[model samples]
Target: MVEHSNRKDSRAAEAHQSSCLDPFGTWKMSNAAHGFGYPSFVSYNGLEMVWAILFYVPRWLWKNWEAGKVSALRMDLNLGIISEVEKKLKKKLLIDYMYSNLKHHNFWAYRYFFCEFLSLINVGGQMVLLDRFFDGTFFTYGIEVMSFADRDQEDRIDPMIYVFPRMTKCTFHKFGTSGNIEKHDALCILPLNIVNEKIYIFIWFWLLIIGFLTFLVLVYRAAIIFSPYIRALVLRMRYRRVKRECIDMVIGKSYVGDWFLIYLMGQNIDSVIFKDVIHELAKKLGYRSRDIGET
Candidate 1:
């Protein structure tokens, strides 16, 4: 009996080990079985495109220009034979030279710095999304509205309480006659075995604070960058004071003017200009109109 019991216990231990090793029910399963996959491909690709366009292209052009200048200077300063030797050395040690010049290359340094900045933003956004996904999967509960009850048992009914799955917690709200809600109340039904809620609260608080600060920084940066364009738009709107139709015509003519008109439209500036620029344009084009407004 002792030998049989030992064999059974050993088998149970082996089974437990197997279960732990193959948590996804199959040994061939991938890491994606545990929810690892592409977080946000669209966002990642868009950021990469923007980075390539705004940072990479300019950096590449600047580097090429600098390389050309260096080559030209070397050609201009050196005699033909020595310059040929330098060219062969440059060809052989191109990588080494590039690395050595990296310290002095402002554009190259700025490109890497901008890439690091973008990486930080991308990682932060992905982390936030991942946290949200986890929170939604595990911590969130769905509510189903059932029958409402009058708690007061009087003509003036008390707020209806919405009890969660665990009956200890509920949310209540009373409707007033004036189509308004009043006397909102939420009751937390604490479990007999209490979990430390403070940590969760702290995490959410920290995320909120960090996210808000990041938002403010981005807004400030955007405002600074676009201030010149904004100023130009405001000036144009103030000075031009043409109808929306005329603005449209101007936009059709000039891309910069189009952006300014878009800004003006977003600002909801008064379009009630007495003078119609389109009408003037039409007249210039030898078209007759009875009313500028009709034109």
Candidate 2:
């Protein structure tokens, strides 16, 4: 009787598996059979073409530029928090503000940095369709800082509470709102956890790292425009007062007259404009100029 019951259970399991493998199931058995074709996998290919033909393309093809800029800004903040010990308190405060005050806003800033670019690329069409379909919804959420109490600080500051999964890595969260807005939030952290959540987070963390590294490599590979060696050479010697006599010792004796002036000009432009920009951004953020240059 036990043997018969075991056979019946085996059959039931198989049936259940078959049901899960149904094409219309939320989770497909295998992606191999989907007939979306290579066009579906193409990045900005057909989509761009369609948008351009429809005259809906933004000037300078900058539709995604805003999203990309936000991602970069978030990355910069994450990198600063991960590396700068002094900024820990400030970072914790910001996170606390986010957690406590954030609600479902018009733009879902949570998912911008969390979701993998590849995943978004694959699901872009459906996402765009949803945005087009729903254009009047808005919500907000907050991610407040929850940390351990610190006795050393007079203000009783909390130790930064990082929700790390098994593997130390970054995480992204993506969501859309009823107001036809979408946003992404990316958090960079170390790989500590090894479980499912950690695995997923690490996947995105690795993806971002790989993407940044690839960009550097490509910049280096284009030797004519700029190479890594040239960049490093320029960076080391650019701000220094390089008299004409000492040019050959650094940056190669080859760049003598206009090129040297151009390099100096580049440095000057960066020094002046970037300082002003930093000052403005700091003012806007209600931070001091010292904060802009910190770490």
Candidate 3:
């Protein structure tokens, strides 16, 4: 009786482990076939449509406001106030200035970086686990353009958009030592019963617009943070009399340039270049009596 109880417990534990280990199994059924299809149109009462529009319009307006702030930051950088601004802030490094200011002024900065880090982890996990270890299939639906079949037609190549009830399947082969092959299939179609084509189109369009605006905002923020380094490079080029060797030596050995480069590399200050630069700066700044590389 004890042996049978132990065996049952072991089986249950094994099943739990399998479910935890399989990524698809957690969200979907294990070794089961699934089919998804949508109706041509979904019925939505006037009240529901009105409510959706009301909810989305405010969100869109807020997003635009945030984007405007980002654009202003970019314009400021373009006008060449980076060095002046940092000096006023009493910060030597652009990264330090940006980090302190963003943390104090914008709560979204933390959320944005957190979301980006999470997205990277999610993508990395999917690429390694799902793409490498799952034999799976996916299907999607879209409208295709068709040309007029009749040659005599005035518009011989009349471009007509036709929405057909169609599906496409893509499969990824699982990696394993076993010779046996296993397959899992999943299917989906557009214009689901819960949402009409108009709603779908509106949602997709707004998502794309928001994504583009977010990208612009990120670019603007990056410009603000790296503007000093960019200005340095531009000035170095503009004043061509400064020899390449001199620039290299200053960049590789100077304290100030080292801090700037560390900021450019996202605060990774443990690099060899950073150490050498710090050592050089220490001697120049009278922080140390001995020069670098000297016994």
| Cα lDDT listed for each candidate | 0.36, 0.32, 0.35
Q: How do the predictions measure up, each by TM-score?
A: 0.22, 0.19, 0.23
lDDT of 1: 0.36
Off by over 4 Å in 1: 1-196, 228-295
User: How many angstroms is residue 255 displaced in model 1 relative to the true structure, after the best TM-score fit?
Assistant: 22
RMSD (Å) of each candidate, 1 decimal: 24.8, 25.9, 20.4
As for lDDT, the candidate ahead, 2 or 3, is 3
Error of 2 at 12 (Å): 18
For residues 87-117, what per-residue lDDT tens digits would candidate 2 score against the true structure? 4443444333323332322132222222333
- Residue-wise lDDT of candidate 1 within 1-295, one digit each (tens)? 6974454334323221211112322111112233322112233345446534643543564465445434432322233234545544533343233223322544433343344455446435544553454323111211111111422344221111111011122234457899896654444332311222233334445445655676665564355234544434443566466444443443333333233333333333223311332335434434444555332
Q: Could you tell me how far off, in angstroms, the CA of residue 107 lies in candidate 1 after the best superposition?
A: 4.8
Q: Residues 85-150, candidate 3, lDDT per residue (tens digit)?
A: 543232234324333342243343334433434433433333333212212110011111111364
Q: Flag the better candidate by TM-score, 1 or 2.
A: 1
Q: Which lDDT value does model 3 have at 10?
A: 39
10 residues in a row with least lDDT, candidate 1: 157-166
